[model samples]
Target chain A: MAEFVQLLVSGLATGAIYALAAMGFTLLWQTSQTINFAQGEFVMLPAFIMLSAIKLFGLPLYAAFGVSLLVSALLLGFGFKRLLVDPMIRHGVLPLVIATIALGIFLKEGVKLVYGAEALPFPEALPQGIWRFASVSVTVNDIGVLLLVFAMVLALQGFLSRTTTGRAMQAVAQNPDTARILGIDVPRMITYTFLVNAALVSVAALLITPVYLAKFDNGESIGLIAFIAAIVGGFNQIRGALVGGLLIGVIDNLSGAYISAAYREAFPLLLLIAVILFRPQGLLGRAEERRV
Target chain B: MTRWLLPAAVLAVLIALPHGLKSYGIYLLSLWAVYAMAAMGLNLTLGYAGQVSLAQAAFLGIGAYVSALLTVNGVSFWLALPLAGLVCFAVGILLGFPALRVQHHYLAFVTLGFNALVFLVLRNEEWLTGGTYGVEGIPRPSLLGLPTQSPIGFYYLSLGFLVVLSFALYALLRSPWGRAFAALRENPTRAESLGVDIRAYTLLAFAIGSGVGGLAGAFYAPLVEFIDPTPFDLGTSLALLLMVVVGGSGYFAGPFLGAALVMLLPEWLRFSESLYLLLYALLVMVLMATCPSGLLGLWAQARERLSRRRPPPPVLETRT
Candidate 1:
């Protein structure tokens, strides 16, 4: 029972990271109608940037984190407007998707070239201590990550619900033509969406770096997990990403604990495939008419 | 007369050139032929059918393993090759069932997951696949009991296969089924409304594409004399797709030209080995941005403009 509790706690912590990433992915998809395959790369770039600032520039952890988030947001905003949104404005969804894929490949290979394809340990700033309740163990970092994730989600939800820009973004996502007709600049809203999504992903990177080592290929694995989470949670829903992420985390951890660790990654993917097969709209997703 | 003679002359030169080239050149040619075959298969699905399949590598791995196992067990290479294609065809059909029902992005995601799953299986199933170490010592094919061990001999064999395969593919493209595939790509709903069974055509595309991928892998096993997971990863699959796109997916000969340039250009520029991938990525991005229609499209446009500008040949009265 203690073991189960411990696994559950750890899984939720890990799931929170996935939730953050998936939230960013969902936000980007919602506003832009373009799924940025480079979304994971956005997470990775911030982590690397933070690491470099701390190690090379001798900056403090807080400063590094701020710098990384700012840079990531700017780069993502610029990249979306220039590389993806502009050329694709006239082309359609397919070209935009393909362009993002190309951008992802470029980002991944570009990172590999700079980082030399080696996993580097991130500097641990958080205290390393654990709380034991009977057989269940909880670490300080895990608790901190969980709290941070919750705070970020709440803030994002508030922003989306309360802010005019946020509502504009949502309106753009729902109907770009309508949004445009209503005097909203759809393109600029998309750029803001990209910036916001990247900022969120950057936060995820900074928080998760302490838990896992930073690496060039780190994004690939986490990106895949986030993708699975998005699908499982229903593609467009923010709340679904959170719920689905936590559920996936628990399921993945439980499976890993009870079964072989090698099969852990397979469980979520299998679940996703099953969900798509049975409930194509996802657990919480509303059914929409298929567009020809 | 000039155009016809030029192509025939070029073909004659190509057929004889391999005999005079060095062993390394012959090897490159053979590799080109094999890749071209694989790229052609990619073209059928992605270009013609408008399906995004990133599992080309998985099918290739299947073909390689099947061929290697069969050949090691003393099965004839000729028999093993067709068996590999047939097996991949079956797997492709199986994958197509779920694939046909999903959206394009969903299909892409599924194929990506499928590729990862295949890689995992290849890495874990040690008893059969030899796991991470992979299977080696695959035998080369024997034509009429004559062993094809030398590079020169292998080159000729591969060339013959390429010629035959290309001609067969060209012929297939001209058939009614090919027209149906094109119609499906142009408008799936419209095609369905016109009595074309969408699922069947999609399955057919998947089967044919996978079969060709498998065929490429089968021949590849003999040439390389080894099978491993590295070459059949998602990277290779994406590279194949990039080749198809960069070469102009709509053109018949685009994949062939694209495959050769992509495969050979890196080797020729081996000095910057580490930066080669970055360069390739940049090139792909630039090409995709500047010329979305691809190199062939650019050439076609240029040719159109040239033909339009040039004066038509003087009218000649022929009394034949």
Candidate 2:
């Protein structure tokens, strides 16, 4: 019972990170119908940026984070939009998908060439120590991650429901043409979606990298798992992404502990195939009527 | 006479080309042939049928391992090669089942997940796959009354397979089956209305394409004399996709040209060392950004423009 509680706490912590990463995917899919295949790479790049700022430039942790977040919002966010996504959007989905896959390779190779391929220990961001309740014990780091993720989720919910810009973004997602007719800047909103996605992924990177380590190829696995999470929860709904992330995290942790550790990664993939096969609409998503 | 002239000249070049190259160069050419064969399969599926498959590498890996395991245990390479194709053809049909349920991006995800799953099995099943130690010492097959132990001999063998595969594909594409595939790509509903069996053709597209990919892998196992899970990962799958897209999907000659660019361009850019892949990625990105249809598509575009500028041939008329 105690061990189970410990596993659950850690699972939720990891699940929060996945939720954050999955949010980027759902956001892009929601707003523009663009699936960023390089999303894993997007999450990966900012960790390197933050690490470089701190190690090479001698910036403080908070300042380095700020710089990394800002760079992400610009380069990965706006620059990615203007450079790759915008030009290819005119073509159909295949081209865009191929381009994003190419972008992922470019990012992975670029990082390897520039930053070296070795995994590096990340600087501590959350508090250290353990909390014990009877036979159950949890790391402060896990608690810190859980708290931060919950706060961010609430803040995002509030912004989406309350703010003018947020509502405009939602309108654009609902109907870009109608949004345009109502004088909302659909293009700018799309850009904002990318920016918001970048920011969310960067934050996820910051939280998860310490546990996973900052490696050049980290995106491949991380991106894939988050994709599975989003799909399992529900591809179309924001709430679904969150639920899916947490669920995948817990499932991954429990399976890794009780099942064969070597095959833990395979479990999520199997779940993904099952979900796709039986429930293409996803657990939280409603079925849409198809027109011939 | 003119049509024969082009093919004859091309054949002359293919025959003469290997004799001039050293062992390493010959090996690269053979590798190109193998990859080109795989890309042709991808072309048939993605280009003609318009189904997106991210699992071609999985099929290739399946073929490689099957042939390797069989041959190393004393089975003839000839028998093992076809067996590999058969296995992949069956598996490909199974994969196509999901295509019935999902379309486009959803299908892409399903295939991608399948790829990851296959990769995991290949890596973890240590007792079966040697657990990354990789199977080695695969023998080159001897044809009737001839030996292919030499690099030059093997190159010809690979080339011979490629030629046969090409002719087979060409004939297949010219048949009704080919037209059905094109119809499926253009519009499934319209094709169904026209009495084309969408379900069977969809399965056939995957089966044949994957069968070809498996054949290429059978060649790959002996060509490299070893097998590992590394080359059969997502990277190679993406690289194969790159070959089809960059060469111009749906074009008959696309895979060959695309395979050459993908295989040989890196050799030419070897001076950059570590930066070669980065540079290659940039080039592909720029190409995709400017022209997603690929190199042949560009040629088609230029030809269309030139023809548009040219005056029409004068028509002969009979007196009323």
Candidate 3:
């Protein structure tokens, strides 16, 4: 029972990170109907930025985190999106998707080329200490991750529901042609989606990297897993994404303990394939009527 | 005369090109041929059949492992190669089942997940696969009394296989099956209305495409004389897709050119490993932009320019 509780806590912590990463993808999908393969690279680059701010610029931890998120949101969310995505969007879906994949490779190698090939250790941001009670123990890192994720989710929910821009964004996602007919600036909404999504992805990276250590390769697998999480949870809904993340986290932890550890990574993929095959609409997603 | 001229011209180049190049160049040429075969498979799926497969590398790995395991166990390379293709064909059909059910883009996840799963199994199933150390000392098949250990011998052998595969693909594409695949790509709903079973044709495309990939992998195993999981990852899968796209996806002769450009361009830019990838990615973007219709489109553009400067000629309505 103690072990199970500990596993559950850790699992939720990791799932929170996945939920954050997946939000970037689902957010973009929600508005623009564009899926960025570069989301992983978004997380990867920001983690490096934060590390460099601490290592090279000698900024304090909180300041570095803030600086990294700002730079990533501006550079990737605004600049790269305008330069690559805006042009490719006109070309059609294949080119846009391929370009994003290319951007991922470019950013990965760009980090390796400029920052050197070393995987840098992230500076500690969360408090270090264990909280134990009656054979059940949770680390401060776990608590910090959970609280930060919850806060971000609530903030996003409030922003999406309460703000004019957020509602407009949802309107665009619901029906782009209709939204445009109603005089909404659909492209700007799409760009805003990218910005918020980038912020959330970076935040996810900032929280998760200290535990796993930041590496160029970290982005690929984590990005893929988060993508699956979004898929299983229903990429259309925020709550579904969270549930998907938590489910994946629990499954990952339980499978690692019970099933063969060597194939733990395979479990998420199997679940993903099964979900895609059996439930393309996802667990929480409602099926749309198809044209005859 | 035109048909004979083109074939004669290509044949002359193929025969003369290997003899003029060094051993390493010949080896690279062989690798290019292998990649061309695989890219053609991808073309049939993504280009013609309109399926998005991110697991091309998985099929390639399956072929490599099957052939490598069989050959290392004293089975003839000739027998193992076909067996590899057959195994991959079955696997492709199996993957196609899920593809039939899911949306095309969502189906990419199925392939991606399958890719990751296959990689794990390849790396972990240590008892049969030889694990991370990889299977080595794969026997190169010989014809008659000649051994393919020599670079020249292997190059010709690979080229022969490529030629056979190309002609076979050419024949297949010219058949009604090819028309069905094209119809599926152009309009799935319309094709379905015309009594074409979308499910079966998509399955056929995946099976044939992946079988070709497996064929290339079988050749790749012997060419490299080693098999490991590293080369058959998402990166290589993307590279294969790049080759097909760059070469000109719908063109029959496109994969050959694309494979050559994709595989050989890096060798020419061997100044820095990282620079090569950056350059290649940039080139793909440029090629994709300049010739949204591909390299053939670029050629057509050049022809248009040349024709414009000359006397007015008959014009064809250009299709987007």
| Candidate with better TM-score, 1 vs 2 | 2
* Best of the two (1, 3) by lDDT: 3
lDDT (Cα, tens digit) per residue for candidate 1, span B1-320:
77467546755776898887888888888888888888888778777777777788888888889999999889998999999999999998887777667655566666777787788788878899998898999989889877799987887788788778877887887899888877777777798999999778877877898899999988889888888788888778877877776677756777878888888778866788877766766666667667665577677767777889765321111000
Output the lDDT of residue A16, model 3.
89
By summed lDDT, the worst window of 10 consecutive residues in model 1 chain A runs over A89-98
Residue B306, model 1, lDDT:
81
Show model 3 residue runs off by greater than 4 Å: A289-292, B1-4, B301-320
Residue-level lDDT tens digits of model 3 in A20-106: 888778888777656687888888888888888888889998898899889988998898668777776655556666677777877
Q: TM-score, B chain, candidate 1?
A: 0.90
Q: In candidate 1, which residue ranges exceed 4 Å CA deviation?
A: A92-99, A112-115, A125-127, A289-292, B1-14, B307-320
Model 3 pairs whose backbones collide: none
Best by TM-score: 2
- Clashing residue pairs in candidate 1, if any? none
Decide which is better by lDDT, 1 or 2: 2
Residues B1-320, candidate 3: write the lDDT tens digits: 68668756876697779888898888888888788888888878777776677788888898989988898889988898999899999999888887666555765677778888888988999898877989999888888878999888888888888889988988898899888876766667788999999878877888889998898889888888998888888777877877776666666777788888878888877787777777766766666555555675466567878788754321111111
**lDDT, residue A34, model 2:** 72
If ranked by TM-score, best first, what sequence of candidates would result? 2, 3, 1
Give the Cα error of residue B178 in candidate 3, in Å: 1.1
> Taking the tens digit of each residue's C-alpha lDDT, what string does model 2 give over A46-95?
99999999998899877889999999999989999999989987666667
Candidate 2 regions off by >4 Å? A289-292, B1-8, B309-320
The true-versus-predicted C-alpha distance at residue B9 of model 2, in Å, is 3.5
